[model samples]
Target: MALDEAALETLGLGTMWVRRGAPSGQGVVEDEPALEEPRAAAYETASPAARPAAVQSVEAKPVAREPESQSVSAAPTESAPGDTPVRPVPPETAKTIRIAPAPEPEPLDEPAWDDFEPVPPVGFDPAPASAPAARSADIAALDWEALEARVSNCERCRLCEKRTNTVFGVGDRAGDWMLIGEGPGENEDKQGEPFVGQAGKLLDSMLRALSLARGENVYIANVVKCRPPGNRNPEPDEVAQCEPYLQRQVALVKPKLIIALGRVAAQNLLKTDASISSLRGRVHRYEDVPVIVTYHPAYLLRSLPDKAKAWVDLCLAYDTYRQAIPNDKARS
Candidate 1:
């Protein structure tokens, strides 16, 4: 029987547990109270706007059974006369439900120290990962002359003060290939062009082996404009500050492929600390362009044994470039 609204409000029970059920068997009679005390109180105290409509309670009672039937676990036998409803004994009297709370999902196995590789530091002075370059999103629409002008006058970091000139990129603005190095070296800083020394000469020869010309078809830039003191690795901060110009240049040039030379360039562009061995010969996407990684020309010079691997990387780059271009346009 459904409880009257007055009886429902008088009890303190909330209506959250209110549900309707049908008879289970022949001897079982379902008794519903006006509302359980807990359910009534819940609804009475609930905000008027949130209260549900028509709350009720349901309980099961067993009628007198056959003499041989001795199941004490069944519902309490019989209901009260008239409007009275039957109530089950408190659950404490009932058997424990044995609800082992899903065994608090075995604490994840702690990774072994050796299994956890160190993360490369995320912050750097001058050029931080926190601040990306500010430039038009579209590279093809950028004004290269204006970009070069800005790079020349850029004082975004202290590197500008240490440099003779901002080794802004030089070569075909419409080039299909882009070369990115760690930053300006002593020779590059002096000449105000990327890759002009022994390493640059090697790079030129490497390009020629693929029939690619430096000033005619390939473009070059560095991660930083100024040389680090004593030719140390350019710190993360330095790259962060100078990357905006490179990002803008890459966007403007829209090269079909980018070759990130050495660890610094690879790490900076990929935001990864993976070893060069792990990175080499693999292709990665830089914006819409395909990026091929190889040993830096300098490193190849130092470790001559790796030059053969560098050649392989170059071949992969050439193949990837060929794949990226339409067959009809591949010759061009």
Candidate 2:
């Protein structure tokens, strides 16, 4: 059956139609060209091979997204033909930074010098050096009183600078038996007396062994009156400067026999650098008086075995004393 306009409109077909195989001019009905379908129009206009691509282009239009941060610029990107163009974001203005300068350091206060007296450096000698030759004559003529006074005020050598007290000879002035040692030690320097320490005690013991005591018939002296710093041996110049005092003592005492204790005493008294071992076991002479050498008490304390040798030296000294004073009966 032939459809009317309402039926054709409802069926979504063209409004007019012709019978099949009818004469071209006999039943021809003219109507406005039917509105073409959108997809069909695109397919008819586009080439058959490009129809799928044309449809895809319309369906997949590219979108231009805004950048997440306003400070950063969007990178340039390519787009398909129908896509929107992307706008670049301008860079944010550079930020300004400020810095502060460091604070200056505080000044320190100066030390107060007026609070205390200044100490002199070690080995500081204030007195001028005097000639030994000029002083020797004056010292030689001084009796015990003047000699001691001179020694007490002596500045002959640098050893005087650090000495606590001058160690003059101790015991009887007129004693027949004289014992000479090296120099004053710390104890002797403080006491201003020689052989008064542990060494002094040992010496007293040794004297008792010989039936003798200090200040009885025994006199004690040292090579150097002043103590060397740290109990060091007296230097050659120190010995030379102090020799006149020792010589004066020897002349006054006129000891029958002299006992030179230790290597320093033996070497300095005899003017020989001979070892104590070589100087021992024999009677040596110093200014016409017999001299005997022995180990120092300080040395014996460290070397207990050598005490026997020191005893032998004491026996030798006693024998020499008896030989010199045949008429004396106190020790006989």
Which structure among the candidates has the greatest TM-score?
Answer: 2
Cα lDDT of model 1 by residue, 167-247, tens digit? 887899888899999988888888898888789889999999999888777888888877776678888878877777788
Cα TM-score of candidate 2: 0.59
Model 2 residue 306 distance off true place after TM-score fit, in angstroms? 0.6
Clashes within 3 Å, all models in order: 19, 0
What value does the lDDT take at residue 205 in candidate 1? 92
Give Cα distance to truth, residue 309, candidate 2, Å. Answer: 0.6
lDDT of 2 by residue, 1-332 (tens): 11353365576453333223332222222231332244346656788678755444433232232233532333333455665543332223346667777877787776678757678799875544445565787888899999999999999799999999998898889999999999999999999999987999999999999999999988999999999998889999999988998999999888999999999999999999878899999999998899999999999999999999999999999999989897455557
Q: What is the lDDT for 75 in model 1?
A: 55
Pairs in steric clash, model 2: none
Candidate 2 error regions (>4 Å): 1-131, 327-332
